[model samples]
Target chain A: MVAHETLSRRSVGSDLRAMGAVAGKELTIARRYPSFLIAVLVWPVLLPLAYILGAKALAGPHGGSLPAFEAATGTTDYVGFIVIGTLLWGWLNMTLWDVGFFIRNEQMRGTLESNWLCPVPRGALLIGATLTKLALSLLFLVISIVEFRLLLGVNLLQGNLALTLLIIALIIPSIYGLGIAFASLVIRFKEANAMVFLVRGVFMIFAGMTFPIAVLPGWMQAVAMALPLTYAIAAMRAVVLNGAGLADIRGDLLALVAFGVALPIVGYLAFGHMARRARRHGDLGQY
Target chain B: MTATLSAPSWRSNLRAMTAIARKDFIQYLRYPMNAVFNVLQPLIWLTPVYFLGKTFASPVGNVGFAGYSGTTDYMSFILIGTVLANFITTVFWGMGYSLKTEMDAGVLESNWAAPVPRPVFLVGRTLASITITAAMSVVMLILGAWLFGFHVSGNVLAALGVAVPMLIALYGFGFAFAALVLLMRDANTMIDVSNFLVTLLSGSQFPVTVLPTLVLLVSLALPLTYGFDAVRGLLLGTNTLLPIPVEVLLLIVFMVVMVWVGLVVFRRVERRCRVLGTLNMH
Candidate 1:
């Protein structure tokens, strides 16, 4: 019985080591590709600056304190609103692409079959990739916030920082689950790039990443409500812009927790079923 | 040791270019889904901009956007900007990357051996891209007209007049950019960065005058600024930064200068690539 217990513990340790190895491999690859690293560091600044410039243009010479903007968004801090929206949208995009398209990337590089043959669980492999992407995305986010504060004079310390961090941390699990489910579709379809773009585009529209969902048409608002990102963004704005606390955002927090737990189970089952189907059809390495 | 053959006849060059364009069109059509997506892509991108405008729209008449852009109808203003952006992106990505794509596919050497001149081949690929982008633009305009009531209030012929010259200038700039891509031996990063920067600087979603003085100066240097102002002025009855005649003349000058510079640079790069034997390295 003691030997059996030790064997189980050893297996758990080995699984963790394999997961760490996978994540380390991804980091090494990213280091080798300097252009991609540069893009990661630079795009967050440029993309948000476009919107910030637009806000300035709309607000005229005074700043982003247009009365109409204040009426619609309930905040005169249009620059901060846009900066936060763009940053979160960028994070969502990186997560979706990095995690959802991981398998598709392997297939394109002719390594999918070998990866599937490995002893480590597929879920562990995906988790490692997601963790690496999460770390990189967080780093980029921090850098972008610093750049905005220094160059654009955006005030980053205005609201409930603890609550904002809590919302962000809670939303990540649901994003991972959604990404995993997206990966299953990619594995089934055998085309990653176009599908990734289409999915990302749909998310951009439905999630209301750049604007409030209330501005969306009624049907679109319904669709937005179903997305975990919708609640997360709303909660984030409440905390960061409105200075709302945990009690104020309890509903959204509960909804996010529900989605965070449910989606991973659904994603894992869907991926397992798709994998089996592909294996049966003898098309795992077709791409 | 024999004397080099004379340049191919103009008629032969035209025929070869047409053949290449036709081949590309056929290849493009094979993926019907791509065509459908292309038609929808602009609309997808426009959705958020539309909402953002509405969020800040003045309750009164033309006070918010018209105060800055000289047009109260933000939808038409943004739609035209989106169409122009599509054209610029096609020029940058489709034309600039054509040669690099050929090299990556291991066909650049074989294509170089063909009787056609390099300029004619490059122009053929660019023309194909222009045709596709123009179709997408038309689809976007029609969708806007049907769904959002975006009508052309100004002279249609006048708008076409402005657009034609601007397109020529844009193509000239694209040729220069294609030559630069050949010299650099990298396309992805350059194309992505330039595309983002140009889209941001061109005032596709707002008035350029609202930008900071420094950024406005940079915008003035971009050809798209003139094209955007002229096209919007003609199509949407908006005010142009400069008179129509001045804008048209500047566009023509840009076209002539850029095309000439493109040819010289492309020739130099061609010789360099031949000497270095790195045409297919990427």
Candidate 2:
């Protein structure tokens, strides 16, 4: 019994060390740079500025324009729309661009071969990195929502928002998983930055994060429907804007679950495949 | 990489042009996924049209309005602006900016060290970015027209004629932005500044006439405004909202002057960066 306990304790220690190392590396890189912080704040600041000014300038041609827009938002709070959009996107953009491009950036920095040479499993590395990003994401998420609320008053369409938070929590892992799939492609192609930028732009357009997916062209609408963010954004808008019941958002919840289940397996498989291909090409360190 | 075309026959010259274009295209092919989205960026900007449709749709309450309206079935009109933006942005971001970035990556150094004529080689990359933008714009046109009922009113060719020059002007601005990136060790500010500047100036959401006098004047000075104005005029009619030709001419002049200015400014940055040996470090 004593020997068994000792072995188990040692195993736990190793796991903790691995997780700590992965998180430590990611935090150091992101925190050391001002660009990362700058990138995080850009969208949130710009949108509020643009919308506030435009809303102010337009003035509804009559009554309190801000309130009217707020009412139009279905939440008496105009901010729910912008807040949800900005914060969720803040996570998504950071994950896809920052965390997802890890392999590519590492390759560029000439650390790929060394990183891969370690005994740690790729799964552990990715999870650890993703957790760090998620934490940072949560930090900004709070800052953006709180800051925006303080500065611009929240619309808070409905109360008891825990389930919404839960849905976001479940989806976060899957979203990073999906990003890993994209990262695998990035690792293979050496053009991750361009892809990251393009994805960021498209997110601004079709992800339903910035604007409603219903407004997209039919094809674009179809594409949006297929994306993971569509469900999250739509549910968010529905709950906030429409005071939607769970039944009304059953589809979105189900979709998020589907994404969680399917993406990790497929994305991990893809990552493994890409890692092998990159190794064969000796470009794992090419970054 | 560029090779001088001294081949004197029309067939050969055509081949050279095709080759240059092809080389540019091949570079874009290196990342099909990214290229696809680069063009899609502008189309994505049209999302504000769907919701609050009841309120936003009044921008084009006039059937003949040359201005942008979120409410009109003229989704294609907005798409025109977006497509033009995509074209212009990709040319700069994908072509000029990426080239300078590649130069720092030592790819440019290697290419320069090779015997390729600098202009010809770089132009091929530009052409590639242009191709992606063109395809994206066309896709946006079709998709936007299908969903929102957009049209080109008087003459499609006239719209084309207007758009070509305006697009040229837009690219000129892109080159200038790229030049700044080359010069500024970091021009994220330029991206932010230009991000709102082009969209706002183009009267993308409302007529310039609605802007403050100074704001209206500034919009008139930008080619982006003209791109949108010419688009509105061709498809919707300028008088429907505001004067269209004012924007069209401004864009034309801006494009012409910017092209020459961009070449000069960008080349100077290239020379300075190369000479300083700081071109390769972030």
Candidate 3:
């Protein structure tokens, strides 16, 4: 018989391949349906377009839109404020909502049970799916930025570039945690599709995506700030708008760090719990 | 020709309509859990948004530009947006999703095979959804009035008159979506398109004045915009009530046309499905 260490190494190698397979499946699906893939780009594009035109109509004559947007969140120019917000949002959307509900969608297609029988740890499959979603959303962010810069005459200002990147990078796992945590609920509840829109609708109002979460009524603002999207947004705004270093976004940066560590652990426990419960109940195949 | 085609008598058709409606109600009751969950879908939104105006610290005084948009009463503004959009949004995707549900259950085809007039039968299925919308709206409106502190200045009777045909028209537009559901197999895509399009049309994020010209034009083209505009005019005390006549007239015409078209399209699908073996769930 082979030694225990060799067996462990073999399992790890297989797990890596399994994760890649899941990511590959998501990419192929997106490629086949280019329309859906393209629409993700449209959402980010709309965010900037709303700002440029609305600001032009509303802002003081010959005084920059950049300064005004910067005063609110610390960025100058429409591109920085809108792009960073949209990019982090795109990341949050990918990691949390997008990958989380893949199982629910699979259930609807009557494919979940069969997919469950495949040889791989559940964690690998989920992580792989999250990887693919984040990849596509990042692609969306790039296309939208380039398109807006060309069509809307917007440009970005450089400031704390590395910190901005760090803030955005920290946003992923926190969001992935939230997404997986909720996806667990979807697996249990059988209403993930409906819940996705409803939950996202609530998040949009609170996340400072369209308008500042500060615009929310007081108690609601507190709730909004608690979400990972809020932290991601605040941190991005700090770098892009306030010319802030990571030091300036200590609170937001700290939040993201905690989210990165805590949320995934909590999410994994919940996801595994839900999956096991469903399997035991025999409802895993019922959908 | 032996009066064989005596043009479907109204008496029997009316009777069949009631029977079909009764059966649909029974179907709704048979799934009590779904019914409760369905009602909760809109109710869940009433709280988070309607009372969340305190976040803005009593509005920005220039929330939508021209100093006319912001208000100490921004909660009411958001309330109207969420409530009206909640009402209109449900109609489109619900009709479509319900159609998909019916098709999956074989109920759509089974009802299609019945001797009842297709319009009556389809209307019967939609009746539960329509009733649900009406009931949910009343509950939310009462809750909003009480909780969100939004007061309506419109004559209550006048608002009711406006809302009556308006719901019919909105539901009619919803049925148009429902009709197309069979033509497009992916209910999720249909839901996404309608949700996205209606969100643009409703101007929920900002005032309609802030919308780009193209989107503004499309908003006018949609039935929901007229409802939102009319409702806002009454609730917000900004625009005049004289334009209410035009909105009412357009809404009525749209209702008739959509209902007629929905019937026609739905019947065609029923026949198409009958030709294929997929009509039944077996």
Interface RMSD of each: 2.4, 6.2, 6.8
Which run of 10 residues does model 3 chain A get worst, by summed lDDT?
A57-66
Q: What is the per-residue lDDT of model 3 for residues A107-202, given as tens digits with 9 covering 90 to 100?
A: 889987887777667778888888888787677656765765676554433567678668767876777788888888888877665666566656
Docking class of 2: incorrect
- Quote the lDDT for A267 in model 2: 85
Prediction 1 TM-score vs. true? 0.94
Docking class of 3: incorrect
Per-residue alpha-carbon lDDT of candidate 2 for residues A1-287, written as tens digits (9 for 90 to 100): 35553323546566667778989988998777667666555556555444333332333323233443444444434346656776676677778876777767777788767866766666677777777877887777766766666666764425438766766776786778778887888877667766776666666666765445654569987877767777887787777667677888889989998988888888899998987787688766665
Off by over 4 Å in 3: A1-9, A29-35, A38-97, A104-119, A143-161, A188-207, A210-226, A271-287, B1-8, B11-73, B171-179, B202-207, B240-242, B253-282
- Candidate 1 residue lDDT tens string, B130-194: 89888888887899988666777888787778777767766666777877887886778888888
Instruction: Note the DockQ of each predicted structure.
Output: 0.52, 0.12, 0.12
The clash numbers for all candidates, in the given order, read 0, 9, 11
* Residue A19 lDDT (model 2): 75
TM-score of predicted chain B versus true chain B for each candidate: 0.93, 0.76, 0.76
Taking all chains together, each candidate's TM-score versus the true structure is 0.94, 0.71, 0.77
Instruction: Give Cα-based local distance difference scores for all models.
Output: 0.79, 0.63, 0.63
